[model samples]
Target: MSILLWQIEQHLENHLACRFGHLNYCSLRLLQEKDMVQGLLKLQESEKTCSGCAIGKSHRSSFDKEIAWRASQPLELIHSDTCGPMQSITLGGNRYFLTFIDDHTRMCWVFFLQHKSQAFNIFKRFKNMVELQSGYQIKKLRSDRGGEYTSLEFSKFCEEMGLERQLTIAYSPQQNGVAERKNHTVMEMARTMMHEKKIPLKFWA
Candidate 1:
């Protein structure tokens, strides 16, 4: 194990400029022929090494079943979700962001909010915008069972508007996979763009 660690350290030092901790899990795991954690710990003498690999590599299971896309047109089905209370608050004191995505075109709408309750108003705006732009009524809407989406007001609005509302089974994010995945993508992109532009971390609102 020590020998393997030495070999990895030497190899990484030659090709990489950053500390071992900065390299991603995949890169570090290459040091081990098998048993990722065992391989990394053999080189534990260096405090400079990133321990992220040891922790991250431990998770090997595949994701839950993906929700099947069943709609054909833009407004035929829409997926809605909200993310955050970002680790850092935005300049305007906004902490949450809502996103609505069309299952067909993959187009999305982003709205920043101070609370999850704002999801209701965002949905209203998105429904109005899409209906006007495409001249097609929303046929179905899908989201997690967050109170924001399942509230009496929300239910009444959907019923009155004649739109079908679908809620994923409790604790089953994969059942709302489209919106769940898009939420991660948007936040990841936001994080990358914010860092690249040197935007203040708080402006994620």
Candidate 2:
């Protein structure tokens, strides 16, 4: 065990995915199959769990499943989320990111921002671009009660456009599961890939 640990530490990026990358079992296997990793083919079969991964990934108890409602057509519903104040600024000087997902198609769009205040403007641009390209008017927008979404101007704009608003209950992220899960998945993949490539953190943006 000691010798194996030493070997992995000596070539961490090339040999392992758990401790340094926080990658889950599925990601490790997928990367391995793609020949994107090397030198630790035996490690994945270990019965012991990776403690570092457990500690880093620990989360609160799961919530009940999402509501039974589903969107039937594109532009019928949209899920939006913001994630940010990252530990490191990206090479592009971004500190945060926003995501918009079409509930029906599950198509996602991402926009980078240097400040949270930029969310509203970026959202407008996203709306215009997507509506133009998809040839569909957005019928509803769903998001948490963030200041960007709650602002008077934002509310008025939505009203004027006849877009229904669906705000999640306070402190209840599970109600906005679509956007929340998308953000989590995107960031997790980015972290794992960056670690695998030994890429600099600043490029994460």
Candidate 3:
């Protein structure tokens, strides 16, 4: 037993020297404090150029907070986003879904699609349906500058309808928080319900 324990300690020491020595002292200390890792005491602190560590530690500055825009009436401003190409296709063959949120009412609409190219048509249908029901014109449309939203046909349609287009800055989803958060909420709810019910992946539509 003593011989086996000594061999294990020796192997751990060798592993610490070869694989974990380059880690910062703080990380070594964390490993020592954790119950899952053994032999952290044998690790030696050393200054090493670890590119992965440097990159992992780097982050973009937080975006400045601003007063959120509020709509005076329904259909005044709408936020939209698309999420998907899920790992499993739905029974309806849909692998993508789009969401639209009315700013004033906080009302949400979801549309399923097989391809992203259907986004423009779906938006058109949503606009007509809502406008007809509420008797209010859509004044503004807000979304990320995805290809589906920025397509020539979509742009022309919005222009003809006199709708203001609000596109978030490149790589900045926070600017479209309403739609982004709605998609997150929808996905999380779907995942939770599916998990609890043991629903099959193909029925996710």
Give the best candidate by TM-score. 2
lDDT minimum window of 10 residues, candidate 3: 52-61
TM-score of each: 0.67, 0.71, 0.68
Cα lDDT of model 3 by residue, 1-205, tens digit: 9999778866665445335423455656566767447644554443343343344333323434447769999999999999998889998889999999999998899999999999999999999999999999899999999999999999999999999999999999889888887676566546544554567878778
Question: What is the descending lDDT order?
Answer: 3, 2, 1
The whole-model C-alpha lDDT of candidate 1 against the native structure comes to: 0.71
For each candidate, the alpha-carbon lDDT, in order, equals 0.71, 0.78, 0.78
- Residue pairs in clash, model 2: none
Off by over 4 Å in 2: 1-64
**Clash count for each candidate, listed in order shown:** 2, 0, 0
Compose the digit string of candidate 2's lDDT tens values, residues 1-205: 9999867754554345544345555656665777765653634352334444344345534445687788999989999999988999988889899999999998899889998888878878888998999899899999999998999889998999999999999999999888998787667656655655667879986
**TM-score-best of 1 and 3:** 3
Q: Which runs of model 3 end up more than 4 angstroms from their true locations?
A: 1-66
Which residue pairs show backbone clashes in model 1? 21-50, 90-202
Ranking by TM-score: 2, 3, 1
Give the Cα error of residue 32 in candidate 1, in Å.
38
Candidate 1 regions exceeding 4 Å error are 1-69
